[model samples]
Target: MITEKCVRDSFAEQAGYCKILGSSFMSDLLTGLGKQLDKSTETGRRVLQWSGDPAHKADALALRLAGALHALARSGQDQALAKFYHNPELSSDAEFIPAVLSAIAANDDELYQWLEFAPQTNEVARASIIYSGLSVIAKRFGLPLSLYEMGCSGGLNLQCAQFGYQFKGVEFGDNASILQLSPDWSGELPPDANVEILSRQGCDLNPLSVMDADDAAKLVAYLWPDQPLRIARVEAAIAIAKNDPPKLEKADAAAWVEDRFQADGAKGNVRVLYDTIAWNYFPDPVKDRIDQHMHEVGSAANADNPIAWLTFEFDEEDKGPFLKLRTWPGGGQAEILASADPHVNKIHWLQEN
Candidate 1:
């Protein structure tokens, strides 16, 4: 059974993560809520009396509430609540928690409804790091890719090949594209390789469509208010996706991979399976199934139909996220290519071109 103290501790812990990710606004906001959230309001009651595991790795309870507050703010339903998002004076030590408490009371029903769903950021800039990995694969194999993404959310990154990228000094994709992801770089730059994505498909339990106005708006709202760049890039990506949306299906991660492997596609293209900060969301059983199934299918991967597993995920030991890759014919060999914060904004290249 989850204790009330445990849930409240998760709020503070998540706030620390927000701070580390360069969102002091989110950090302070979450801190204020964690310190003061009580059973006076329906939302507070539901949050405190939650039955499920509320850790970031489990239910992500803190992020759910944070996303909920952001959604309510974007709706323009509460003026006082919106001020706490970015206003320095309003978010000061004395006034911040009061503003948070007031908002929870005023928007009790909406916030409570939001807790039923998980948060989906669909961060667009992280694609730059994924593109760097793609660049390495392209240069190494000199082949087109059949990309499959797990926990795809809006499938915005599925259109990664369409977005502009700059890894260190090396550039890829259309320079004039509305969405440009140029993360801070170091070490040898990724080689300027011709990366072609022959096919793209992704799976998510609760997939959002960029073409859907409501979904699009919801995605934008989840972005931290202090980071307008994320908001702008998402808007651009959403606009681009509307022109030619990638294939996204609602399915379990394990089931989707099994189905995709069973339904063979065009030969000779490198089959890449990738995800960003999404692995922790999979339940232990689901994780095992996906891993076991991948190993089974990966055993058959050959030079002509190679398979690559790419990931951008947190490493508690490293105190930050790392970009890692494993490709069969040598599936057992794993390579860490780069390191970056959760958003992949300021990154250090780890591999030589």
Candidate 2:
């Protein structure tokens, strides 16, 4: 059951997320839209009794609405609203709110259908942090990596090794590649060792296909209107993906990890299971099962065929995202390599300068 207050709060929370991530335009837009939705007789009458896991309904609704708006804009149904997004000067102009509202009212049916699924932000820049983590692990183990990712939307990060990276005066990967991540780096540089990815695979409940035009558009829809650079990055990744889409399997996160661990590690390879900003979405039971399976596999790891769990997730005590690495055979403790923003706009390495 979705209450008016519940919907408002969800929008408010997403507003906060956008504001913190440096999108004043989206933050204000969402706040105004939420208030309008709370007071709209049309919305109340048209939007059906909300259906989904109660925990995610609010965010789901907000994302669905955003998708609807993007869909309308891309379809050129609302030139005014579309212009507001395409031009920077038009942002923060409250005059556009009425147009946005009208767009929503016209497409309430499609928006409601979108609410059935959770938002798949599909942030690929996060793979920059993952690349750093992998580089460190490779330096330690000296073996090629077999990568597995949980909640990999289009599995763009699976191809992180193919993209160029620039961090604190250091550069790696294909310098000629169109996509590159150069986050504001603070503290000491990460290991300079080259990490070889022998394979890349991931699991998503409903994976987006980078090769599909509609699927790629949905990813763009999820981006905040305020960030042009991010929009370009997604486009760059999509272009690269068109040539060779990353291997993504549709499956439950915990089930995939358990199945992967059922067999011994391949000879002379280091199996690394990694996820970024995706850990919190998993239910307790699923997380518990994945954790148990990883420990079991880590315990049996040998020097020649080792295992590592690399994560860029929130540390409860620190109340922030940290880049962490835990390995087997010799790695029993998780190491905090760096602390980062929810997006890879900024990263602070924990290593000594």
How many clashes (backbone N, Cα, C below 3 Å) per candidate?
Answer: 0, 0
lDDT of 2 by residue, 223-300 (tens): 877778888888898888788776889999999999987547777989999998778878899999999889888888
For model 1 the local lDDT of residue 42 reads 86
Residue-level lDDT of model 1, residues 1-353, one tens digit each, is: 78889998999999999888888877887887787899998899999999999988789898888888887777778887777664633555677678778888888887898898877789888898898899888887789998899999999999888898776656788788888888888787777888898988999999999888778877876778788888889989999999989899999998998888742445678889998988877888998887887777778877777778888987546455889888776763679998888777798888876
Query: Whole-model lDDT, candidate 2?
Result: 0.79
Question: At residue 18, what lDDT does model 1 achieve?
Answer: 83
Displacement of residue 204 (Cα, Å) in model 1 is: 1.9
Question: lDDT values of the candidates?
Answer: 0.83, 0.79
Candidate 1 local distance difference test against the native: 0.83
Query: If scored against the real structure, what TM-score would every candidate get?
Result: 0.84, 0.88
Model 1 per-residue lDDT at 67: 83
Model 2 spans with C-alpha error above 4 angstroms: 5-17, 35-60, 92-95, 105-109
- Give all candidate RMSDs, comma-separated: 3.2, 2.9
